[model samples]
Target: MDAAESLRLAARSIRGHKLRAALTALGIVIGIAAVITFVTLGASVKAEVVGQFDDSPANRVFLVATPGDDGGPPAALSQPVFTEYDVGRIGEFEGVDRVVPRGTIATSALSRGGETVARDQVTATTPALFESVTFREGGAFADASSGEACPAEMAVTPSAAALFPGNLSVGDRVSITQRGNRTRNVTVVGVLADDAGLNPLAGFGSRPRFYLPTCAYDTVVTSPTTGTRQNVYPQVTVIAANPGDTAAVQTRVQDYLDTESDAAQLAPGSYEVSARTNEDIVERIENVVDRLTQFVTGIAVISLLVGAIGIANIMLVSVRERTKEIGIMKAVGATNRDVLQLFLVEALLLGVGGAVLGVPIGVAGGWVAVTYAELPLTLPLVWVGAAIGIGLVVGVVSGLYPAWSAARVDPIDALRYE
Candidate 1:
């Protein structure tokens, strides 16, 4: 039969038993829908990760201090907390880049107006620390006119500024508490629009970094209150030699700590130091999403497999019901191939119809779900193309055995059937 006639006949056959055809295609529809939704969601997550980290400015090395090493998986290591001395020495190695030390004091306090306040971010650093980061702010701590009287100078982030009273200008006094017991008076020297956002939703990292100028940090440490003070150990952070040299800069930092720092063991197996490129964060996120998509798609594949079995069963019934018709066609001019093609064409049409209908439904559903639920939408062209190809193959392959069984029926016996 010609292509035109085959398609027309296939359409008629499907129309003849529309209900059974619909029931059989139902499994395929559900399966393809599931695969499309999950894969798209995973791809969207990957795209978001890339958008966030691909052009970031922060250094990627982490120096974590822990207890004695238990020789097992690469878990936490054993070392005392890193110190200013360790941070300073990291800048001397071959690949070494500039390092910034970060520390935090989480607390709640009242502004001078007796308003309740809470802040969890405090970084003790110099004017250089502010310059090293991407700040959306009026300015960093150096610009603040914090004298000795207000030794606890803090740069308030825009998010924190909202909790304060009106006329909340720079140089306002806010009483901040540390560890819930100490309510120390801190200066609001500068206000940053946003320092960090952990998610697309406006959330902050540990109360937005409140800063103390390096010059007065020691004095603030020694004199916590009017007279009391405590040593606040700083967490070490490094900026790359440049934007592209994150890996090289991380190596230099590790080398410097190994040869020069007092805690030599920290450079070895005693501490956890991690180096990452901006793109590395995206790759990690994509990996997670891919795993989730595969899990969902596996369930969908089972449904498609069941649908294929239904196609086979339905074709067997079709061949049996029309046995005399087949015998008459064979006795005339029809070849075995023509008889097989007729059955195959009908099965192929079912898949082609499903693909034509299913892909758009899947795409539309993706858009609606993403827009309403606020999920990012990302299109991975390669995965999509692969899915389309898979659908075509499934259609042809699922039709094959049934077509073969119908063609193999002996004409004499088929003619004698009741």
Candidate 2:
């Protein structure tokens, strides 16, 4: 018999017992589906995380404070506590890019119009921040002029703007009331917009922004001492020369801070350093997700292996039941290869068929996971292709032993047995 005839016979056999065929391929279906879904999602997560740097300049870096000898908690690390000089010294490094000295004013004040909300660190930064950090709504401020009070003007985040009439427009006024019943009225100047897919306002205690010039601090911050201009220290922030240059910048900044006679003088406590590039945190998240995808896919494959075994067993039984038929075919001059092809085709069809049907099932499963699980859907294309390939290989290999056995039966003994 030709290969075409063997394939036809396999097809007809599968049609004759549709339910049995479907049940036999069930494990393969589930396994392929699981694998495809996981790989695709994993890849997507990886891309999303790395994308944070898409809008940044080739080189931009952010530096926060190092804890003092008595480190406040790990959570405090994120707290705006770094000195402005720390960022200044970091910028002093060779190949160093411009640095944006920033400080987040942390304290709530009542606005004159009764739009009262406790704002988290009200940031005072130089215009250099425009290149350092991405905005999702309004823009950042201009460079703080030396010895000049920061403009009464401020930039607001979309979330922060939502609280008032028409949001914080370029000319709106916000009042910052501080201790001793004092208040400072500041004008809104800019808005920021971004597509990093993050909650644009996840920071600032979930309140909207009211960006102010450093000079605005004079109104809210009472000088703690006789000679200090403002009590707020800069939360060290630096823009990188390029994404690739982050490691170099980090080293330079660390070395600079370590050498600071003032930094070394900080109250004795363990000093820890942590740096996050534009995409570093996101990459970390994606890695954890990819690991999880692999772990789950491993479990699904076991079921597929079992299904292949079932196929092998079924083919063996068919060989036994058709012993007389096998002998008759041999007597008619049919080669062992022809007999083997017939059974092998059937097994291949079962495996491949299951895989084809399960792809859509897996895609639908991913849809459900994204919508309900609240995870961003990320597709891993390579994983899907591998899953399908695995299915076909499993089918062919499982039929091998049974097909070989059927082909080896002796013609003479088989003809007399029935």
Candidate 3:
């Protein structure tokens, strides 16, 4: 028989037993859907995370203090390691354009016009921190470089501004309560643009925050052992002189902290310094997502195996039921190759149908998941093609034994026994 004739015969045989064919292809549908869904979701998560850096400065590097492996509890958590002196010295390093010390102060509430919003902590950094960010209202407050002390002016993110009854604008005075019930009223000098791309220290997601000069939080972060107020920092941001020089500057900053910095001089082998760029962080996040995708994909492979077995089982039953038809076909000058082709095509059709159906289901599944999670939608088109290929291969391999059995059946016995 010709190839088209074989396809017609195979499809007619499948259509004769619609429920059985549907049941047999269910495993394949589930497997392909699962693989596509997970892979698409994984890609979307990576895209969302990496997209956060799209607006960030390429020359910015973060210097963080961590505890050494030989520690009891985390030393950096127990005591402040990076001081104002350390930040100043880093600013003087070669290839270093600017350094901003980020310190957090325990805050109770921010109040304006009898309206109050509670807060945990507020970040304190220099006015230079806002140079790269766009302002919606006023500009960045003047730093001490202008022959005046850092002013008691604050910049607020859009999320922070929304916490009040009316969105905060320039020249608005709000009372800030710090640790120990220290209340200080500061003027809102700037409101950051909505898409300000203000990356917080330690990889915290974008959220409501207010910024002031590092000096404002001096009394809030006093040294525990010394009982004295010090402008200590857990994180510092350094900017390289040029955009592409961050890697070299990061290396130098790490080496300096390890060998010559106060953290090294005061307590040797007790503190570990980390200097990382935005690209470094994005690469690390991608690696983690890739590993997780591999692990989930492995589980989906088991479902494919079960699907292949289902196809084989259904094909075997089909051969047995059509024994008389096979015998008659062989008696009428039908070749063994023709009979095998007929059976294989039936299995192939089932697999291909399952794959085609599963793709859209998987895509819808991925879309719903990402939408609910508030992440960007990313389609795994490459995986869609792979899934179809997988289905074709599965059908061919599963139908092999059944097709061979049908081809080898005795025409005389098959006709007489039935």
TM-score of each: 0.73, 0.66, 0.83
Overall lDDT per candidate, in order of appearance: 0.60, 0.63, 0.80
For 232-284, candidate 1 gives per-residue lDDT tens digits of 33245566666567777766665655565544533345454433344443454
Tens-digit lDDT string for candidate 3 (180-295): 99988889999888734465343435578888877676533343334544577777789999988899899999888777675454333555666778876667567767778888
Would you give me the overall lDDT of model 1? 0.60
Which 10 consecutive positions of candidate 2 have the poorest summed lDDT?
195-204
Better of 1 and 3 by TM-score: 3
Give the CA lDDT, 0 to 100, for residue 135 in model 1.
Answer: 43
Whole-model lDDT, candidate 2?
0.63
* Descending-TM-score candidate ranking: 3, 1, 2
Kindly list the per-residue Cα lDDT of model 2 for residues 1-418, writing each as its tens digit. Answer: 7778888988997787788788888877887787666655655554544454354444545544445423232223443434444445566677677766555565566363766766545766666655545565456666566766656667766676776655666666778765455667776667666323222112212345556665554322222222233333434456666667777886776665555523433323555444444455344445665667678777777777887898888778778877888899889988999889888888898888888877777777776766564556766666566667777888899999998998999988888876
Model 1 RMSD to the real structure? 6.4
Q: Which stretches of candidate 2 lie over 4 Å from their true place?
A: 62-82, 101-127, 131-154, 163-166, 171-187, 193-237, 240-251, 257-289, 300-303, 306-338, 367-381, 401-418
Candidate 1: pairs in clash: 67-78, 224-228, 224-229
User: What C-alpha lDDT does candidate 3 achieve relative to the native structure?
Assistant: 0.80
True-structure RMSD, every candidate: 6.4, 6.9, 4.6
